[model samples]
Target: MALLHRAEIRPTKLELLSAWLPGRPWFQGEAAAGVERVAAYRFDDPAGQVGIETLLVRAGGGPVLQVPLTYRGAPLGDAEAWLVGTCEHTVLGRRWVYDACGDPVYAAALAGAVLAGAGQAEEYFEVDGHREHRPPSMVLTVDGAWRATAPGLGAIDRVEDGDPTRIVTDAVELAVVRHVGTEPGPAGARLSGTWDGQPAPLPLASAAPR
Candidate 1:
């Protein structure tokens, strides 16, 4: 489960993404007009430390781009190259946000979800000592059953930021789909999602043992 606070953030998620999206290798075209939300989902950190969220957005009417992000209270050591920038959180103070592709915590979580066929986290809003349920913007499902498998999910062994960013762990490799409606992907377990405009299931990420 994931907890949320009713707070405002400076340099909103979209605002920061607008300036960062165009520079990415996976970005198809210039985002002069910025990006708009297509769908979003979250995964929980077992230690309850980092905030893990993935956003799917469209720029200049182009393909939907999947961007996984991890938010922390302090800077991640030697990860300046992966930093997406920082923002002020009303409740949590300042946050250091990074591209999840480079964050080890996200690497472990992503592999765990794909191999185990886990779904997105449930959300709850916290306010004035009360908790309220909040429906997610979209829903995600896996292609197979929950098969227990342990992949070497320690440090990131490699990362290639192609159209489909390939992330490698010690024992697994995951192809995170950058463009929603692209190729079917390599043969393996996959994560698919559907939202308002997107009624049919769409591939979001694919995983295979390495």
Candidate 2:
């Protein structure tokens, strides 16, 4: 279960993304008019050391763009380029946010989600000492091409940035689609997501053993 504390966050998520999204080479819309959060989902880190979140935001009414992010308490080594800037989480103090493509935890999580059938994490909100389960903003489903062995997600080898971010790990290659409405996904096991007002399932990612 993902526990969320009722704390104020400075430079709000949207504010931070607005400044960072436009610079991305794969980004297609203008962030000047402002970005709007369309939906979001998350996966849990088995070790509970990092937070993995995928945000689907729209800029200037353009197609929803997919941005996977990881939240950590400290900077990731040699990942300054993927850094999305830091934010102060009133209760959690300072947080270093980085693009998920460069974060091994996220790559592993995505690999499991796409190849092992693992889905989004369940979330719970805490306030005034009371905790309640919170439904996910978006729902995801995956094609479980169950294999005899689990993915060897030990280390990420390389990452290629573009419309669909490519992540190559020790045992699997996962591609994360950047645009929501892109048709026909990658080959092999894949995962799809759906949100309110969405007519059909949108392919989020695909994975194949390396």
Off by over 4 Å in 2: 148-150, 183-185
The sequence of per-residue lDDT tens digits that candidate 2 reaches over residues 1-210 is: 678878888888888899999988888786788799999999999889898999999899678999999999999999998999999998889999999999988988888788888788999988778889999888798775676434778678888998788887787888888987774245788889899988588898889877
Assess every candidate by TM-score: 0.95, 0.95
**Against the unseen true structure, what C-alpha lDDT does each candidate score?**
0.85, 0.85
Model 2: how far is 47 from its true place, Å?
1.2
CA RMSD per model (angstroms) = 1.5, 1.5
What's the true lDDT of residue 158 in model 1?
Answer: 87
lDDT (Cα, tens digit) per residue for candidate 1, span 1-210? 999999999989888899888888879755788989888999988899999999998888688889999999999998888899999999999999899888888887887788786668899998789989999998888885346753556557888888678887777788888888775356688888999988999988888876
Structure candidate 1, residue pairs in collision: none
lDDT of the structure predicted as candidate 1: 0.85
Residue 65 lDDT in candidate 1: 88
